[model samples]
Target: MTSSAANRRTSLSAFLLGALLLLLLGGAAAVWALNRFPQVAQLAGLQPPADALVPATQPRAVATVPIGPQPLTNAVPVDALPATEARVATLEARLARVENATSRAESSAGRADALLVAFAARRAIDRGVALGYLEPLLTERFGPTHPQAVATIVTSSRRPVRLDQLAADFAVLAPTLKAAPESDSLWQTMRRQMGDLVTIRRADQPSQRPIATYDRAVARLNSGQVDQALAEAMRLPGITAAPAWVGNARRYIAAHRALDQIESAALLAR
Candidate 1:
């Protein structure tokens, strides 16, 4: 009985090994048949789509922004490639033109802002305030030329001054300087007082009296000659008492001179 059982077990192991070998061979044969005949794969539901079965005849279309090469599966027809490339080129050219236009507009806007700031700085100078506020703006927009002019003006016009108003004040103060000096003799003082009392000069004509010098100074100040007016004023006897007026006149002259320099620099900049 032991001999019979051992033989039976050996026969069963041989049969199982034979079955495994047959299954492997059959699977390999099926694969070969599917490769050789597509109809066999289709019948077995293992065939790819018809489009996938053919090799791509055209290159794939690339994006305008360039994301690198694409696969053949993402390829397009050869006839449609020229239209796609032309469209991308046209879009790129239009985008370039738009960028150029934007650059030009920004440049123009920057120039406009500079000009406006220059105008505002001029107004501030005229008003004689906030002068320091314009220095950096002028330096940034027009460089050292305008900023230097502004600095000179600020230095020269340390005191606020105006020629027209100063002339009016001088007109009101002229009568005070018309009297004779305290150092004069009694005879001269009497004669001067008598001459003033008997004075009958024409209102429309220039006088030959000491007061005529003050009148001339007023005219010079009215004509924008602050230096000449101040010179004439200094010649008067009691001029030292009006030091504030003379100082303001000096500032007026200096400020205008600095303004002339600014104008010259601006013209050159233009």
Candidate 2:
């Protein structure tokens, strides 16, 4: 009888060991699947959605008065912000991401939308140096007119800077399919070929007829085209200072390049 009981116990232990092995194998498979499709929240239990997850919610449209009895200008509306500590914590985290982005241009364009989402994120503006770059994008993407764009930028940002650009690559393919493509499908395809949008290529260089111009130039002084930009700036109607476009060219013209933050500052000044 003791031997019989021992045999029964042995059988139970073997069964448990087999079950444990199966569980381990299943877990390994799940890890493999999860690594490939990161958006899947469930491990082989659910069908994955077709689209990858993007944070939903277009930021609520907010207006900054460019002109009013009290036009909002670099003013903190912290008093109007909600008083939830959790929300404040979330904002602090987001601000950290903006502060840590790879480049100034990237940080500005990538972070503006998210920053504007925080109802009172504007107050945090006093803490960093992103405002100058952020404004132009917010204005171009959201506002209908330059004046409105300018006003929105000036009022929303704690740091106000200038806006300058020689060419803009209005994505020809990007215009809403709801509109006609003829009016849309052209980008001097960018002086774009040059790479930076803040740098201006005389949209039409002595055109016999005309040229459809679309482009955006950004900093170096491009180093590659600094000499060219300088020559052109010298010829402009009545401007003396180095244009961001020319500065960018000059930057790229050399082996090592840095407009010394001049690109961003120049862009903001524009």
Candidate that scores best on TM-score? 1
Error of 2 at 110 (Å): 82
Off by over 4 Å in 2: 39-52, 55-270
Q: Model 2: number of clashes?
A: 37
lDDT of each residue in 1-270, candidate 2, tens digit only: 999999999999999999999999999988787877766645444655545355667889898767657766987588745666668989999998786764665756645543442222233232323455555554553344234433533453443221222222112211221122233235633333333334445766531111111111112123334444444334332222334444443323321121222223323431
Worst 10 residues of 1 by lDDT: 261-270
Candidate 2, after superposition: displacement of residue 82 in Å?
52
Q: Kindly give the number of clashing pairs for every candidate.
A: 0, 37
User: Of the candidates shown, which would achieve the greatest lDDT relative to the real structure?
Assistant: 1
Q: lDDT for every model?
A: 0.72, 0.42
Q: In model 1, where do residues sit more than 4 Å from their true spots?
A: 1-122, 138-149, 156-158, 180-208
What's the C-alpha lDDT at position 138 in model 2? 43
